[model samples]
Target: MPAEGVELTPSPQILTKTEILRLANLFLSSGVTKIRLTGGEPTVRKDIEDICLELSNLKGLRTLSMTTNGIALTRKLPRLKDCGLTSLNISVDTLVPAKFEFMTKRRGHEKVMNSINAAIDLGFNPVKVNCVVMRGFNDDGICDFVELTRDKPIDIRFIEFMPFDGNVWNVKKLVPYSEMLDTVMKQFPSLKRDQDHPTDTAKNFTIDGHEGRVSFITSMTEHFCAGCNRLRLLADGNFKVCLFGPSELAVSMAEYGSGSCLLLD
Candidate 1:
């Protein structure tokens, strides 16, 4: 959020435990096989481990993943892994400690690095590191992030900055997908494009013999709208088929009575 935005209100309207599981189960039959638990900070939830445990038990679900800041993963990841947590996407923008603090206003950069290593050791397939690429900000670390994929099996993803409510988006800060690729290909001439998975949001690649991989999530300059297949559930029980569209067609998960809330195209 920008400094000029309104004060953050405490939303006391999140869904209950039953509602989350119920919602998860409801979609399982509809071919929604993956459920990713996220939050303003999901690890802050006291019941996150239990949530993962329950969702992992859902019969038809193929994957249960999470995207976290990784502040609390050092202690919780082992249990989360045992409870059938499939993978993780950890967010860290800058490699420099000073810049990390300047960007996130937090001092837990080391913890995030620890969590990334810990996930790799614990067998989280392709432990992904998400870097939101901004032109004058953490963009300098693009190659540095890509270097991680050379030896280890971590998948480093360069994400384009996106505009959402309350987020302070600067058009000048945007680094297009082409720029990121050009920068990497210039430094690492051995890198070659990998075969793509149709539903994968990121365009992936790998080096000649590197254990890991790299990707560009080109949501801005080269939008992948034509191949999009996504749905999102908000913290407050409301859900949406599209992440960019204005909030609409909310189903009240607090009280479970539902009709077709989303139109399948």
Candidate 2:
């Protein structure tokens, strides 16, 4: 989070539950089976449970997942799980509490940890933990994250820091996927390669005795654009077709009806 904070979008401008469902249904009908509720911290929404319920109940929607910081997940996960939230990816960049505070500019290290445990306790098998690895920062904690999977069925995913607006992204800070993999292999030479789905973003691996697995989202170094099957919808109903690619092709849900939106491709 930026220290000065970002300008908030007005409530009226953001897509309402009904509008979100309409778009979700439209996408479902178009063969989009998975829908992930990502954020600026999705748990902050007052009607998040309601949103999850409606989305999860949508026909043709196979998964209703979320990517959250996990600050409020401990209290929210049970309700969210009841509402049919299928999967979770909790972002905890570092294991060190002090470094977490420094990186996020907040004090929620314990809360995030609690949230991860809460998800695991609630039968969220193979609960994923997303760690954005930056050189000279939390990159040193790579093995520490891997250790979390020793007994628990967690998927510790190391993501390469990619350039984004206002993130002050630099090449120096970027830790490539190969480098990360090599670092892990040196510590655990017996790490075995795991099969991945054709469209899976992360290349997976598993340790012989560990309950969980490890993977790397090699967006910066190894582009998965060819087999990419992801789409993003902004809060204001704008469709972001690609995460790293240009948004010149962005389409607004307000301007187009369901039929037109589906025909956009």
Candidate 3:
């Protein structure tokens, strides 16, 4: 995950098309199938379309997705789709503007909603809306988020808030998996879990006769560290094994001789 509150570097030292292509080629050759671009906010990067295009063209690559705050997706979804973006996971905490601004420290709730609509309009399948549920922060909007996507094809996932970024994470602030299910079940009495694609972090549920689905990501109450398959490469080239894992390996293009590795046992 991108570190929040870091000073933005205003230089033109961003990754070039050729460098991105090289990195994509290396990962594809290493038997990696899916690639996701994430950051403090990836959409803010200049010329992101070019980077997407290069990755989409890589051989043997099965999936190309992105995780964004959705602040800039509305204006770039079409172009991004053309460049082979298959799916999107947008981070939207609350439907209420005041709470959203307070959580993200930015005013982009309206823009995020527009981006979700734009992504759907662009034919992105299963557009996912990621909502981090904190007990007293935005838990009140869980039902609202679920209702918002009931008629659409989007998937709204309610992620249990975890301790990170040195924030004062109170265990009581976590909306437990049981409570989340209870909330949705009350609204849709016929809601059932989807066992087709089992993901440990999120308990997937779908409403009867609805096109969308809702999920509860109980990361703290339930961990899926064993089956986790992801390696985060920081913008400056640090390798992060797990989101909550402490072990990390920092390398450069020169030291490692041009390849990323899984350092975790």
Candidate 4:
């Protein structure tokens, strides 16, 4: 979240539940098996459970996951799981409460922690915690987050800070994956390589005797563009082929009224 805050798109311009399903079904029919409900914060939507329930039931959709800030996730996770949410990725840049509040411009550290615990309790396999490591920001907390995986079965994903829209993007602030891995190795010399999926962006590892695992998303230093198989559909119905790439197509389901005419034929 930017300090001045982001401009909220008008509600009427945002895609409704039906429109989201239409686009999702189209993608599923086109052989897209995994679907993750990312955001701004997927938990904020009033009809999120309804959306999750319907999307989980869609044929050919193998995964129904969500990436949330975890503010309202604690109470919602049980229902969300019962509604068929298969996976979860919670973003917590800092383990320090003050730093968390400063980074997000909000006071929800306890809530976020509770959400993480709740997800683990609910048995969400590979409960991934996303931590974007910035040099001067939360890079020092890498081991702190890694320690989270000491006993729990959580997967701590330390993501390299990358350039994106809004906020200042400086090379000095970027913490490359190599540096992060070295930092971890210094602490846990017993760190051993773990197998990763062919298309996985994160280079995974596990420490001897630790029940959990850690992975580094080296988006900055080592680009995974070739193996990258991800597309982003914005809340306002804009289609982004890549997170760092330009918008390739724009469709306003609000204007088209969930009609197939707006879809690619």
Whole-model lDDT per candidate? 0.80, 0.86, 0.77, 0.84
Clashing pairs in 2: none
TM-score each candidate: 0.91, 0.93, 0.88, 0.92
Candidate achieving higher TM-score, 2 or 3: 2
1-265: candidate 1 lDDT, tens digit per residue: 3546555435477766777888788877666777777756778878888888998898787888888998789889999998888978999998888898888876999999999999989988799999999989988899999889878889999999998776778898899988889999999988788888677789999988788899999988877777666667776666665667886557654433332221111
**Predicted candidate 3 versus true structure: per-residue lDDT over 77-147, tens digit per residue:** 89998998887899998888888778877788899999988988888768899998888888888888888
Please identify model 3 stretches exceeding 4 Å from their true place: 1-4, 8-16, 196-201, 251-265
Clashes of each: 0, 0, 1, 0
Q: Whole-model lDDT for model 3 versus the true structure?
A: 0.77
Order of quality (lDDT)? 2, 4, 1, 3
Highest lDDT scorer:
2
lDDT of 4 by residue, 1-265 (tens): 7787889989998989998899888777666788888878888899999998998899887788888999999998999999999988999999999999888899999999999999989998679999999888899899999898998878999998877777688899998888999999999999988887777878899999888899999888898878777767788878765677755567553332221111111
- Cα-based RMSD of the predictions, in order? 3.9, 3.4, 3.9, 4.4
Best by TM-score: 2
Model 2, range 9-76, lDDT digits (tens) per residue?
89898888898889888777767788888877788889999999998898987778888999988998
Off by over 4 Å in 2: 246-265
Model 4 scores what on Cα lDDT? Answer: 0.84
